[model samples]
Target chain A: MASALRVLGVDPGLTRCGVGVIDVAPNRAASLVHVGVVRSSPDLPIERRLKAIAEGIRAVLDEHRPHVVAVERVFAQNNRHSVMGTAQASGIALLLAAEHGVPAHTHTPSEVKAAISGYGSADKRQVQTMVARVLRLDALPQPADAADALALALCHAWRSGGTATGGGAVTSLTPAQRAWADAEKLARR
Target chain B: MASALRVLGVDPGLTRCGVGVIDVAPNRAASLVHVGVVRSSPDLPIERRLKAIAEGIRAVLDEHRPHVVAVERVFAQNNRHSVMGTAQASGIALLLAAEHGVPAHTHTPSEVKAAISGYGSADKRQVQTMVARVLRLDALPQPADAADALALALCHAWRSGGTATGGGAVTSLTPAQRAWADAEKLARR
Candidate 1:
């Protein structure tokens, strides 16, 4: 049987970046490995804050060593002040993923919400409840961002077919899925 | 006298990033060291393109070892299609600078135009012409982005007191300037 796939998810931000790690078994069961936020003081210079975020990501990567990374994609329609910082933080995440030879994927907020809660427009509370239930945790993860990060990881795992059916075996991948896997392998190399 | 300071300027973009390096003497005289563009195919995935940019900036930093790095600050009002990519590329530049122990500064477009052409709203052609004249180049640099990058470096140098009077020494810095300098030193340490 193929071993479980480990994934790291990042919710990029300048002041409070969220990171989550999970392992998805071939049978589609997911177990949370870790979750937390990397905070930077707003009073510091922008570059320093960026550095802090990068360092935090580096530490997480070192500790978790996930096979793949999923980051939230920033869109222009987001808050102006947040859009830029989010983009910058996302860049750092992607760059570090490339440097560490880990394949990185981006998931939109709606996509993550849909994957977790079965609704594209699921609110934060709904999403949080779903994530906690899916992971079978006793309590919801604190700091809404961390829950969102976990949802992103789960979304990628399910969308990529890391989950199996009732038969509990891997199914054949679609051509597009095969291509993405090939690209991920190439990127790692 | 303090030795001439080398500066690397970046005009951040995912498709066509511009890089320029120059040496500014204590008396403010500037000489061009290098100029080039980092191009990424639009057909590639966004992460691959961003990786290409980060690699390009890394190569420049390795070759130039500039005392400082200057990047054009990206604003939200820029072309919607380009703004996120620009911010991402800018983040890479700043991260690389911090990694290499080089101070990085951001200059707004208007500041670069004013420093080179004596008008904040100067058109591109005017800024290019002034940049060529200031650097005593035989002809204007090809690709307007490269010219803007050179202008950004020159602006940082001139404004930071790289050029001085007969005393040929730095003048008293403003409180903001002092704070920036302190941050740079701390980042290097």
Candidate 2:
């Protein structure tokens, strides 16, 4: 039985976190599964926002049952206040993944674009277009952030030999396949 | 035999994530347990940074085995770029707590200050002074971020009655006691 892999991609944020899920199988194309956003406000205390992020994300993970999580890696911010705040929100995403024993894969902005658009410097619209094309969707996903997240998940689905089932693989790769698998896993942006 | 509770407080960042752990008893105050920082740079891709943050935080969690994890909540920022970047880092901290089965808590800047100091609007110096006083330490914890994280943990320790070990007696409280508890737990600022 060929395994199918479901992936969830997260674009972390304090007020608006974009998320998407995708599924794929070995030697097969990727499929867009699900996508949405988790929105928190600045007026809300950090604790409340965290609760929202955590609960909302956990709901997504449980609903999708993705085998892998794709997270956009942290980029540097010039403003200290903004950087710290963003990092805190990202922490919530990581926590959600860890809770379910799903290992998170990270990808750079450039890497996601390069994998999707054949250019590292591709713009958001171009990447979105490619994501739609790859997923065989007629229309692009709403909310650019959601589209970006879906793109990240699709990137992972395309790169990693996906599971045939919509969820994730239950088996572990051998040491020989571990490094390549880790690289495949971690490289999903 | 009474079991001591170990709490880990984290200040999440893409460049440097500060971690501090403390041990506390029911009536006795907190003691410095362990402190660490995970550093990453923009020069490296976000994949590497996420891996570093994941590995470093896991090591800390494994080594310290804290019962609770407290992280400073994300604050508002005007800069869009910085906000996005830091949000990602905070996600890492959240992931660490969930992955390890450690209950996670979050504290706002003012909540932390009010817990450390008598007032919510207290300055850093005042908060640090109170932290030193409350913890009975010779000096304020170095690096404002680390101290802030430690203060956040203390704040959680205070409101949560320390380590979540002893359940608060559901005593009928005087209006004044109820007011104080409400203010302590629900105060916005």
Candidate 3:
């Protein structure tokens, strides 16, 4: 059996950067490894804020040693004030991935939502709930950023088909996911 | 008079990041120490592209030991596709500055233009021409990006008042700058 595939996900932002790591088994059950947010005070200069984010990401990459890293793609149409900071933070993540010799992928919000909740337009709460169920967590992750990051990781694992490993206890899909799968099957027919 | 201020300026882009270093005398005469662009193939992945830019900026920072790093402040209204790359590239420059313990500043396009050409609405050619004239270069710096980088450095030096050196041979302003200065003086009345 192949070993579980470990993935690191980043939800980039200037004031709050969320990061999470997970291991996915071949049967598609995902287990959480670590999750948290790295924050920098808004009062700091742009360089200092970015420096803090960079240090936080570097620490995670060094400790987790994930095989792959996934980051949320910042869209141009987003809030003008925040988008630049988001893009900057995302850039730091991608660069750190390269520096650490890890492959990196970026997913848009819609893509992550669809992957986790089986609906492209799924709201944030729905996506977070799905993530909690998939990982068998007792409760949903706090702060939308943290949940979004885990969803990004899970999205990458599922989208990058056949990448998960063979070893690990396989957990059945949640009823909501089963319903979505059945609905998709019916639509295909 | 204060010692000459060495400033490194970055006009950030994903494919072609422009970098320039200059020394500004207290008399406000600026000399170009270095100017060049760091190019990364668009064919490379985003991570690799950002990595290339980071390495290029790091090399300049280490070699030049500039007192301050100046980057072009990217606006949200620019071409959508290029703005993200520009912001990301700008992020790398700022992060490098923090890592190296150098002060970093960002100047808007108009700010740099006004400082270099005495007009906020100066076009690319006018700014480039003025950069060459200010540095006593026989030829205009090729590629708008390189010239823009130098202009940013000069702008930072001039705007940061009373920061240039006391010992360098003083050079008088050109007729064009003199005209603008005299015009401004008359307007104040």
Ranking by lDDT: 3, 1, 2
i-RMS for every candidate: 1.4, 5.9, 0.8
DockQ-based CAPRI category assigned to the predicted complex of candidate 3: medium
For model 2, report the TM-score of its A chain.
0.79
Between prediction 1 and prediction 2, the one with superior DockQ is 1
Best to worst by TM-score, what's the order? Answer: 3, 1, 2
Over the stretch A45-73, how does candidate 1's per-residue lDDT look in tens digits?
A: 67778899999999999998988889999
Which residue pairs come into collision in candidate 3? B3-B165, B4-B165, B26-B165
Residue-wise C-alpha lDDT for candidate 1, range B1-189, written one tens digit per residue? 248888888999988999999888755567889999898899976767888998998899999888888899988767568888889999988888888887788889887766666557879998787677767788988898788788888777766666312112345864234323532333343
Q: Rank the candidates by DockQ, best first.
A: 3, 1, 2
Q: Candidate 3 chain B, which ten residues in sequence have the lowest lDDT sum?
A: B162-171
Q: Write the residue-wise lDDT of candidate 2 on A9-110 in tens digits.
A: 998777778899877656345676788998877886555666677777899988878887887766554354455545556666665676677776667777
lDDT of 3 by residue, A8-97 (tens): 999999999999999877555678999999999999989999999999999999998988899999877786688899999999999999
DockQ values per model: 0.51, 0.19, 0.72
Over 4 Å off, model 3: A162-189, B162-189
Q: Which ten residues in a row have the lowest lDDT in candidate 2 chain A?
A: A174-183
**TM-score top scorer:** 3
Residue B143 displacement in candidate 1 (angstroms) = 1.7
Task: Report the error of model 2 at residue B54, Å.
Answer: 2.5
